[model samples]
Target: MTTTNDTRGVASQELFERCTQIRQLLAAGNANFHAIGVQYNLIVDTRLAEKAGFKNAPEFLTQQIKELSRSTLVTYGAVARAFSAEVCSQYGVSLLNQLIVYVEAAGVELDANDPSTMLISVPGADGELEEKFFGECTVVDLRKAIQRLRRPTSSAPLPAEVDARAQQCSAALTGYFPQQTGVRVEVRNRKGKAVMSLKDVPLEQMEQIAALLSTALRSSRAA
Candidate 1:
């Protein structure tokens, strides 16, 4: 696959404008879920061009874009579509917000003009570190918070309140696995990379939590 770096002129402008517009739409809750899907298909056109040796050809880019699935296309047609419509839908809004707030509150702002970014560490079910994002947040502090929240207590099952909050933390990981359709309650290792335990819980609970995650990721990206 040949990737073109010449995203100058109209292509760049189109991407930027589309991204800005999508942000405005989503912030106002005016986003058409189906349309987002359509955009996704169009955005994937670049890949098609690369494979077809047409990466530098705008004609091929436009032509390939016309062939994507209408439903999923909108979700990736532009920068905003890819992040907002697709990534956010998969991740969740509230989770993203917490990330943004967590980072901002920690005073880890990024230089818009620079490529360098910040990193934050969140804990997984097995008390292992999961690198969350590069933002304006303190990685050490976030890791500390996740560690404090996930550690099993001796007296009880980590307390009812603690369990609930910890579950919220787990829900943030829905972005990592698309096959996770059901709710999972027990702590597990990230993608089962290590010897982590898995527990299956009520399906309804998982769906609800996943919804929150999707919303969070979307909103956080926008913020």
Candidate 2:
């Protein structure tokens, strides 16, 4: 039993608010478009539509983009493909995983246990030979689950001397290594686990330290 006057008043108020919001959004969109055009030095001549087979400049641009899609330039191919796929999926992009893959493909030599490093293992010439290499170096610690990733070795069975020597070497070399003066090395055990961490040592020096640790561990075990 709502009164006609009251219902009309509510509808009118709702319509007014919606109109204001729509107007604001339209203004913002126009501003953004103009900014983009200026930045890109685009000539937005509306008259070019007839020659370009479109009713308006915007329509002309849209068709041009579609044409470009069929034969994409190498520089824009990957980005355009990703953008189109995301738009088809309601603007959802698989950014994080894709970036991780890209980062992990950039090669850099590093110890297997290094928390900042990722290793990619590939098959070698022989079926029994596996080639292990370092990929991207990152500051973000993926330590906990990194072992589950493709690694050359495991954790869990490193000699106590390996840990001690790595720390000693880190203390010995204070100002070297890219990105940080205090270099840290994380070594993976045979099981692909990062069982030791050493900081502030040069890559070459760390190798020597590892070799020494291996010998000491072997001798102690034999004794």
Q: What is the TM-score of each predicted model, taking all chains together? A: 0.20, 0.20
**TM-score of model 1 vs. true structure:** 0.20
Q: Mind giving the per-residue lDDT tens digits that candidate 2 earns over 125-174?
A: 35342323233322122221243344554446556666555444444332
25-66, model 1: which lDDT tens digit per residue?
445653454344344344354443333344532343335344
Model 2 spans with C-alpha error above 4 angstroms: 1-79, 83-88, 95-187, 190-197, 200-223
lDDT of each: 0.44, 0.38
Candidate 1 — number of clashing residue pairs? 34
TM-score, structure 2 vs. true: 0.20
Candidate 2 achieves a global lDDT of: 0.38
Clashes of each: 34, 11
